[model samples]
Target chain A: MEVVKKYSETELVQLLQQRSGNVFSYLYDNYSGALYSVILNVVNEEELANDVLQEVFVKIWKQIDSYDSSKGRLFTWMLNIARNASIDMVRSKGFQNSRQNRELSEDVYSAGGTSETKTDQIGLRKVVYSLKEEYRVLVELSYFQGYTQDEIAKMLNIPLGTVKTRLRTALIQLREIIKP
Target chain B: MDIKAYIESGVIESYVLGMAESQEAAELEQLSRQYPEIKQAIDEFEAALEKQSLAAAIAPPAGVKEALFSSLESEFKKDRSQGQVASINWGRYLAAASVILLVVSSALNIYFYNQFKSTSTAYQSLLAEKNTLIAENQNTQTKVLDLYNSMQMMSDPTVIKISMTGIAGKENNLATVFWDSKSKDVYLLPNKLPDAGANKQYQLWAIVDGKPVDAGVMGTCAGLCKMKNIPNASMFAITLEKKGGSATPTMDQMYVAGKVG
Candidate 1:
């Protein structure tokens, strides 16, 4: 495994804009894994995750013009694109048909508890697990599944305001858990 | 602004996590610039989420990279091949050069022909400008002659310059009425007034023997213009009325008044 050298956001953005080979390699080495993880969490299948990751990167390369620095980080922007692509894949008729026999758990992500996760990730996962069930579900729906506050509220049969405040409390709990 | 309360509101977290609506996201972008604390809170939450994502990072299947980079290499090669065609080709350049020389000679002929035509057109315009200048000289001479006569009248003590001040709503308006009592000639010079609409006009009234008499209708409120002379009037007033003046002054529309001393 090769470690991608770190770059300032400015330098990375310039290289990405120029579509440099060196920068593309660096981006792949640094971000592809984290992006793959996000996709895997959403699709819950290694093969579909692989396909979605490839599709996401292609979309990123094609839509590089739409990326803006003022809106957020490069990684965050890429994360957003990756999350949407994965969620879209799982929502497609093909994906639903493939999984027609299995009952999809409302909190399917919690099952990753016993999977072979990274050592550092295990610590973070522990922090996530320590959060109350309500807080954890909000984090999962919002962070992993990419559900909006309104969507989360509708899905859980909760008020929109309560969903917003609960998500805030969950983040506060996360801050307390992960604080140095 | 309670920066702490704003941070605690979880809107920043929602924004960072890509859960904020379009409008709320725009506001968060603006707030980050306005408040350093909001910016810092956003940065911290982003860093925390980034860490969590990184920890769960799964090295993609090894074949995926081999697949992705090969496609990238093919794209690079395609670009290079397209660039290669654009590089100088001596044989093609020699053929193009001879054709270009022939075209260049014809283009030069057309260019010079246009230059000559435009020069003649410019010369004709200059002659027209000279004619206009001559006419303007005659017009200026007439104006100078009128000014000389007006200056002669101004120096005469018999002609009085009455200053009219604006009244009520038209407080900023002003005008001057030059009265030559010996000749009974009244000239109105408007300084400023609220612009009346196209159908409105300012009418002048002379106070003669405790009764209002029509002085004249002032049209367009332009330069020093003649008005009906009332040699025995004690005071003068201006009123806004319908276009072409009115039979009687609209008393409530009186904009300015002055008493001759």
Candidate 2:
């Protein structure tokens, strides 16, 4: 982790309200990687993910005032924006027309060439890859795709109760893998 | 609150993954606010999810960060320009106010200065008039005292008063001589006489037992003037001479003559 300078949540909120560019730049430097990963995971294409990533940041900058600190962490709100923007992009006609040539089952992380070379350099990335495919796919659909439990159940053709249990199990497994 | 039952409900995980239904999310938000255990569970799951996302972190194309920053910079620059315009408006107001103040003060200064100058001129003229009146009043007072003394002299019986009529073809010129025999004092009062030329004055002479003795030169005499006393003088005469009187009288220049009775 690149230990960027940290600000308290209150200070961060105030800075964002002021629309301070320095804070925004610091936010881009620290969180863009994670946001890009979530974006890349949803759209599963490099060019599409890049376009979606830009839209996500622009929306965040333009609509930062709507963020409510009481609702969730700043990162969580940004993640929701990124996931929603990526999902919206994936549904667009242009993306559908362009992406029809590629199979849906293609690996999401296979496009970023640096991920393969740098996977060994970062310990957390190697640890997360050890996550079982069954639970990883559940985490992806629920978290990165912004799918509601009902939607996830219908899409996966599982019971509504099973969708919740499976997402919970996926989170627990990820928690185990993420622990130091 | 049963922390174990709440943890087993999978609501925390659903909330963390953004998979919770609107109602479920609302209920979880309320529960989290009420129960610290639910909040803690959600935070833990969120942390795990964040970790997993970070693991998948791909350095975004470098161009995206530049593009995002440039957009923000342009926005801030736009805001600053508007701010400058606002500040410029206040500057214009201040400049106009100061100009008005300067104009008003200058006009007031000119008005007051003109008033003061006119008042000072009036005061100077009034002071000059008062000085001239004081001088004239003093001259009048001197004349009144002289006339009063002359009246007293005329009333004394012992004082000899002689009226000298103009002689030498000058009949209109007249003079008076008052003699106090006991005190041997003589006073001449020059009356009508031709105007003296420049550098010339009227001189009076006394005849002491027939010889002429110089008395004194006289100017325009509107009052009594004491002449030199000649105790044995039998007659007196007036003649015109240079500004400073001569050693001897010019008998041919005699304008008036009188004899003691």
Candidate 3:
């Protein structure tokens, strides 16, 4: 459904405060496909993908008030929510292992220019792709999987200070790459 | 804190990405107000993350948009349909009512006190008259004893007791057929059963072997009810049947069952 209509952040939020269909339609048009793809990638099963899709909207309804344009764009906030939910689905013991045969993270970058709409990770993959292994891994863990740098440090078997350094340099590389 | 140096340090970027600890995030959030550039930097970082994350979206089902809108209408309409009823505090109303009652009673008390001063004997005489009526009622109390005795015999425990429990996962459901085996009658201890909704009623079944035969549709009991002549059977069942009942038991919706033997 190519319903991804344009709306300013404030107008969209006001519509959401009213809980208008226009707002949810905008959400469906813009985010549903991307989130569905995200969830499908993580859970790697169609049924759970559908379930997570339903759950994502339910979360949006329940948590509409939590979104703040001052912090970031609507898509970033929603992506964070969708990612966390999909991760929860993957982590649940009920999900059989080995079902996720293909790399799910690749699907994250494959969905055309949805990420280009926001600013922070502009050419994130481009810069990240060029990053040294340490910085690249840190950027992936911190941004994609929503891991805190502290957690990334432990996962990457590095010191916390080094994580902060890698993340800083990684963002520099991303800035240079995405700088118009 | 030097805001430009701090922003250049890329700590705000880390904070925007949610990799910063609470203290660092709080500090950055605080400093972002002091310097708009830091705020702008953080906002830019947030925007970029949004763009990058947008890569994850997948097309939902064909009707998901319709489902979302319909659900939104249903959920959001509850408040709009009922227009806002600004709830009045009933407690405050009760307090005002009690104060009004207190003032009225006190005024009446004062007026009565002044009247009593004019003829004190009238108040004494009225009280004496009320005592005489009470004494007359006390003299006729013996007949009430006979009626109370009849009620005791009817409610007596020789009223048979059959044990019952709720269906598994339905702890509120209960069925007990208390038979006055001598009278071949049944009394359901409905006090134990959870309440059901309108037009919904529980039907009792007398099961012979595995088959359920209808016994009777239970009548509402404040706590207890008496039904006549329950067939002697090995087991009793309760099912959510129609307003009345089926001639035979419906096995699927049976709420509770246990054997008498």
Which numbered prediction scores highest in lDDT against the true structure? 1
Relative to the true structure, candidate 1 has a C-alpha RMSD (angstroms) of 35.2
lDDT of 3 at A130: 65
| Each model's total of backbone clashes | 0, 0, 19
Per-residue C-alpha lDDT of model 1 across residues A62-83, encoded as one tens digit per residue: 6777888877778888888888
What are the runs in model 1 whose C-alpha is more than 4 Å off?
A: A1-6, A101-127, A178-180, B78-261
lDDT of 2 by residue, B31-67 (tens): 8898888887777767666766666678899988887
Which pairs of residues collide in model 1?
none
- Tens digits of per-residue lDDT for model 2, A110-154: 424532334323433344355676665566556655566777678
Compute DockQ for each candidate against the true complex.
0.22, 0.39, 0.17
- Each predicted model: what fraction of the native A–B Cα contacts (within 8 Å) does it retain? 0.45, 0.45, 0.40
Worst 10 residues of 2 chain A by lDDT: A114-123
